[model samples]
Target chain A: MKKSSGDNWDSLEKNWREKLDSHKEEVPAAIWNQIEKKLDEKKGKAVPFIIHRRQWSWAAVLLISFGVGWWQLSNPNALVDDSKMANHIQTEINAPVQHLPNTSTPELEEISSSTNPNVVSHSEPMPSHDIHSNLNQEPRNTTESIPVIEESKPNTNPVILADNRTFEKEKPASLAKEESVEMLIDIQPSQANNQEKENSYVPEPSKKRHSLFARVVKQLRQAIDGEPVDWQTLKQGDPKLENSIHQVANTYIKTEQVVQRTFQF
Target chain B: MSKTLLPFKSEQELIQACQKQDRRAQQIVYQVNAGKMMAVCKRYLGVGPDAEDALMEGFMKVFSKIDNFQGQGSFEGWIRKIMVNESLMKIRKTANRYDQDINETYDIAHPEDAIMHLGVEEIQNLILELPPGYRTIFNLYAIEGYSHIEIGDMLQISEGTSKSQLSRARQLLQSKLKELQA
Candidate 1:
């Protein structure tokens, strides 16, 4: 199967000779015009897309962050919306002690004040509206700067803390799909008694008529389609097959095999 | 003349303009390659209209992948390879035409006599006139001079089929020419 180098070179030379031979036709002028039109159409369609893709990702990121901020403003359980929580964490990193939750609104506010910036950055970005839009036009707000006001300390990872914590027992009365945090907590108790087992996520397909019919249809259709077909396939002894004949009936029949008497010409 | 690729306008200016999404550059590239790509595409398609479709698709691929052209290799060669690939891919989608692993030896003795008898235009036209499956294999094997092994691998057929197809293509061409002579 291994070819000699000389043979390969000879092959290349032969190909070139053939290519020269094949390109001898003068293409009609009209066809060439049509080809140009096609190219123009393609270039036109793609030009906008090239620019759009290049710019859209940044816009998408900003919009998502903005959406999160709006969602937080109305929601009481702000931490359930991870994006807004992360944005708040980033904004609050340098926030004054006055803004930090005091004895009045204590636990979360104290946690916010103490949380490390490194941990804050890793969580989802808050739905912060274009609060920082002016940063671009201004000389510098320096979001990237991470100002050296606070001394660097060994920061514990928040995700690890979140994963390790034991979730509170779900009170059946408080269980609601509308509250994501409650639903998450609700789902956890099931993992123990496992009311809905792991496979519950993809529920067992019920033997409903619609579902069974679709699966049967799909299998039958697939079985009949695409593979090689033999010329002679026949089912036995049905009346349809008993009457089925390949040859044309010499006499025309109104509905059956026999033709009725014809009228005089 | 070859060095002055753009001559009055310069191909580099046009290519750069194309990079900037210029209409004029798009027009120039289309105008320059349409005829040749059509001929290439026609070799791999069932009919002229399908060939045109392949031609359009190929040119689109050419423009998109133009950045990958290293400039060390022949520009037309690079573009031609892309166009050929596009045409072949299009052909595969429609039909799995490789029938019976063609296991026959070709009596190809350099085809010198036929080459001498036929003009380049005649030969090119003859190749374009071939049926899609045969024309494609012929072009890849004879003109591209790909080994039967390479042609088989590329077309998803056995080496024997590639060999037989090339021989069949050559035989078809010779017969067509003989008919014209008669």
Candidate 2:
């Protein structure tokens, strides 16, 4: 007998082959229509692409960005009024000029006096002798140190307390440290009432205010800023008037001899 | 209207049409040899969507590389090799070629013992159902007669891995067929 395509040779492969062969033979008209349509569609738009200066992908990128940017700009919340921002800046620009330590308090005299211990700590007898010897120096001059003594009617005002609290925040280190240290440095023992001292004591009136630092700060500010514009000259437009009057006669001294030779007999 | 419009009616015609950039000639070349190329593609791609991919892919190779056809051997055979190689290259892209030994130490009571009970259909179905990685290797080595090195080089796998994967595919395919027959 011939060597058969035997049953032992696996009918599974044989049947698979048959199935596929049949499928090839009998592709349905519908399937063929789909295939044809696919081919036709591919060829339908087969216009040989003509490219100019730009890349195709670049055009795609531009299209996407423009669409996105257009949508973003058209949104209602995208715009902001700049005038409001300007007004905010203007308000900040015109904010009040507040001096920190000028706040009022019942202890104002004592506080001002205590700010400088050097003047108040000088022996009173020495100051009396100097005042007597200095005949040219007036006792009541505006820059002289004045002495103040408190009378016995003490009052507690809420406004005074509030102002003291505000200015106390800016106290110098010696004033802010132990009350004993402050007392030891400059206090006259006669005014020490151990009874009233149990309560908070503001600086005593025998202290003298320090104006030297403030005077120096004023001078530095003037140096940096230059003298404030002279309002009278500015108003009159008279920049040269001072020089013209002061030097006119002096400038003609050299020319006088030449003028005499040319025009005098 | 032109006689060459039929595209690749003969090899001479194909060469002539190819020189003219005839799209129809390309199409005809594809249609004529698709079945044979598909057989080659099947050995490389195995049975699946990948085979379809390999089919289109090999056609492109056949067309693009047709210029290299020196008409040395049967052009159809040359064409078959290109399609086969194209399928393998695609498979190479998708598959790991390193030979994995599913049963390097296979204690398979016996390989024949597993397949003897099954009808051919059950076994072929088992093969069809195999994981793509194993099926591609099995088909390339057993049915298509590719050497292990050729399979490895074509699929980018080591020869040892290719041999091991085939052995495993056979064992697994046989075992599945056994289970089905019962």
Candidate 3:
């Protein structure tokens, strides 16, 4: 076998390269069709990417807004304000009931309390039967009852009376003044007896159990009202209330820690 | 039709229009270069629909990667290189499908003057008669003017293998040319 030298191949390559240079064949028109179709396919793919990006941006915005709303609702300070409002209402309702125990003739006290303090002190004292007659007329004029109490309190400290009137006005219109007066009359002694029994009982567990039940009821009511409940406010009353508040606070703290851990992911 | 009347006389303007994806500019560019690019594809692939497929794919690559052509070399040369690479890829795929090696040697007597009498189409037919691997290396080394080392690197073979393949390809072509001349 003979091996060809590089020069022999170089000359052969030169002839082929020159001959092939002028050899141009027309490209089939079908190739352009295929190319155009492929280009269209690529364009189709690009459009969906843009649409998906826009969709993702909208989803991100919605998620951020929902997170902010959840944060606002879960804030503890909003619950504190609701608890304070509940405490104020409780105090006002208890005031009239507390004064009930001091009077023997309840009808006289009701009639006299409704009048001006100066008028009650200065005018001739009304008979017990006449006070009962006034009480019978009281139910007929429920709307005028609150205004009469306001007008009769002129001799008292006006600022305190004005605050009371504003508080009274803030109460729901569905709770009639006459109904409240009747409720006060009915519950006064029972409330007094309950207070005495609560103070006399030295047994810690029974008292604690009772207060815990009351705190749970109150917290559930606050939760229903879309408010945050403050377990700290429940700490001021009974030893049981304090214990229950501490237990609730510990549970809340643990739950919050769990939430924080979950959110970290 | 009115848009087609616009002048894109220079290669720079045409490339810029192609970069901007002007269809008319791309079509004009395709029409101008397709003939020569097809010729380059046919050299490796021979006269077949496979060469046409390679030409379309090569042009598509040219239009897509037109931004990469930095005007350092001739535009036609860059396009020709892409066509050659596309042909090599197609050849590689075909070689894999058949699973044949170019190490099978052919015995032929060298006919020095016979090739000169053969037409270009006859010469192309003779080259296509060689096996895929030999045809690829021969086209790269002889017509495309690549060295044995470059061909070795491109095909992942040793330089010695490329040289041996090219030798066999030349001998086969010489014999085929001698037959045509007779």
Displacement of the residue A234 alpha carbon in candidate 3, Å: 30
| DockQ comparison, 1 vs 2, better candidate | 1
The sequence of per-residue lDDT tens digits that candidate 2 reaches over residues A125-159 is 23334333433444432222223211221231111
TM-score, candidate number 2: 0.36
**What are the lDDT figures for the candidates, one per model?**
0.51, 0.47, 0.63
lDDT per residue for candidate 1 within A1-265, as digits (tens), equals: 8665335435544654655634622455665466567667876887887676535544543344344334433443332233334434544553342211121133332343344222222233322232233223344221122211111222422221111111112213232222233223333443524543431223222333234224333433343354442212321222221111111111112212211122111
In candidate 3, position A207 carries an lDDT of 47
lDDT of 3 at B78: 90
The DockQ-based CAPRI class assigned to model 1 is: incorrect
**Which portions of model 1 show Cα errors greater than 4 Å?**
A1-265, B1-13, B106-115, B128-130, B174-182
Worst 10 contiguous positions by lDDT, candidate 1 chain B? B108-117
Best of the candidates, TM-score: 3
DockQ of each candidate relative to the true complex: 0.12, 0.04, 0.28
Each candidate's chain A: what TM-score?
Answer: 0.21, 0.15, 0.25
Candidates 1 and 2, the one with greater TM-score: 1
* lDDT at A260, model 1: 14
Model 2 DockQ (Cα-based): 0.04
Angstrom error of the Cα, residue A51, model 1: value is 9.4
